[model samples]
Target chain A: MKHLVLGGVRSGKSQFAERWIAEQRKQIVYIATSQVWDGSMAERIAKHQSYRPDHWHTIEEPITLADTLKKVASEQPESGVIVECCSLWLTNLLCAENEAQLTQEREQFLAVLENYPLPVILVSAEVGLGIMPINALARRYGDEIGVLNQRMAQICDQVTLVTAGLPMTLKATQGK
Target chain B: MKHLVLGGVRSGKSQFAERWIAEQRKQIVYIATSQVWDGSMAERIAKHQSYRPDHWHTIEEPITLADTLKKVASEQPESGVIVECCSLWLTNLLCAENEAQLTQEREQFLAVLENYPLPVILVSAEVGLGIMPINALARRYGDEIGVLNQRMAQICDQVTLVTAGLPMTLKATQGK
Candidate 1:
């Protein structure tokens, strides 16, 4: 079983996932996808790092999420694999600029999930659920991430929405 | 074939790997394994993020190394899969506290390299080559990561030692 989380900014989605991952088992591995390009984002990244327990393994990946997930999953498919959110990942994928590469990378990431070996938990932002973006690229990103999430949800055994520090199960097939 | 990089702290190993990954004959996907927990690390992460070109795909994973690699290998196994550094990751795995889980994870991580789908590169610190540490845990980590790297070097197709921004191939094997 895998848990897919979606929510808005400051929606407590990451916190929910972190706390949950910490509790799942002793061998916790946190997969972070955020890149600290600015002071604000740097602060955000630091805060996320400080939250983890000392023993949890961490791999800093700004891209190649699907590949990294496969690596971890293949090694410990039964262990917890928590990727904070896929929204940023989708953004990264679409930002590849080359249309063919972007499409190819997208398919590759999806394939990683499709053949995922363990109980993987993923968190992503709910793009376009509230409002459509005015800018072309922003709108495209929103649409793209929404599509990515749907593609993932279609295959995920469980899906949950995190709002106001609350978790409402969306696709709960079998909660392990 | 994958190009391996081994070095000490602040030796520009990551920058070297980034450059190599960027100069690849295929699309680039960064598989990061660092998470932010403090102001210092956040700043470091931000600096790295800011330096990256806008077109590359980024995947944020603080953990789950083997699974991610396998997925990328399966998707683009022939291109390149350069995973930056295994020191921290080995530390993360050893911190599991559960011997069974630790051994399982270690075995799994090592096993993925045997018949991986892609040409892979691994960046790791030569921690043990330096002076022994004063602290017990620090020394343990140094020892553990050192052993991990040595074993990886044995299985890897090629190994390179990077010192003062120069790379010397220590071991080489033709990849299938």
Candidate 2:
């Protein structure tokens, strides 16, 4: 079963995803997509790392997500993989300024996810609800993320939005 | 019934609120809280106006929301009121730089809404889901709106978060 978990910053999406993957009763593979660009980001990464169980196999893949997922699924068919977030992954691709790489990576990831073998959970930020940003890059980021989320939601068997640490399911496929 | 409708940009929240209010079978009072701050904002306001029905009584109250709501509830107890959004109203208050007025207005609005006589639907942008803004004002707005949404969700009989033109109920009081 594939799941897409969405939430705003500090919305407890990670915690919810952690709990959800644990419930799957499989060896957990936590894929961290965040790349620390500043002091605060570093601190946030540290905090997230502290919250995670040390025994869980953690893979920090800022890009090339599709390849990483394929490797994990093939190597450990019984593991439940959690892509800690897609928003940061998107940011990383955009910042690289490699248009071809970005397109290929996104398309490949979606293709791989559609027929993934293991129970995988993906986390993303729902960032399009506020006033449009004045910065051009910020606006572009918002548009890209919004479309990505819609596409991801379509593929996932279950989609949830987290707010105030509470889970609200958006879409669910029964008996999946 | 008091409902809080939360959504991201272009999340179809207003359309959902309009549909919900119409189902109530009461005369609709569309309280638009958007102010024309720029050319883009003016265009948005015009577009929203075009979508609304000609018969629905429309009131543009950017600030002074609590007083306006109180007046509407008392004078038109039988009518259903729709506050098109709280995000813009918060922006107006923050831009005005009046801390005391902001505190009083938010408090008054919540207090009045709790026991409001008529069926009321409140719309707001869930703007805290994305990357933290670099600008201080933007950061502050994010913080304020997050707190405000949590508070509104608590008071509302039903709370929904809209995404990609779909509604997900976050909280609901049974038979309410």
Best by lDDT: 2
Residues A77-142 of candidate 2: C-alpha lDDT, one tens digit per residue: 889999989999999999999999999999999999999989999999988766676888899899
For B143-164, candidate 1 gives per-residue lDDT tens digits of 4664566567667666666667
Give the 10-residue window scoring lowest on summed lDDT in candidate 1 chain B.
B126-135
How does candidate 1 score on lDDT? 0.69
State how far residue B72 of model 1 sits from its true place (Å): 62
What residue runs in model 1 are displaced by over 4 Å at the alpha carbon?
A: A76-78, B1-176
lDDT of 2 by residue, B128-173 (tens): 8766779879877887887788778778888888889999888888
DockQ of each: 0.01, 0.22
- Looking at model 1, residue B141 earns an lDDT score of 76
Cα lDDT tens digits, model 1, A1-176, are 66788765544678778777666666777888777667856976887788777877888776778778878877866577788767776666667677786787678878887767666678887745433536677778767877888998998888876543446677878644
In terms of TM-score, which candidate is strongest? 2
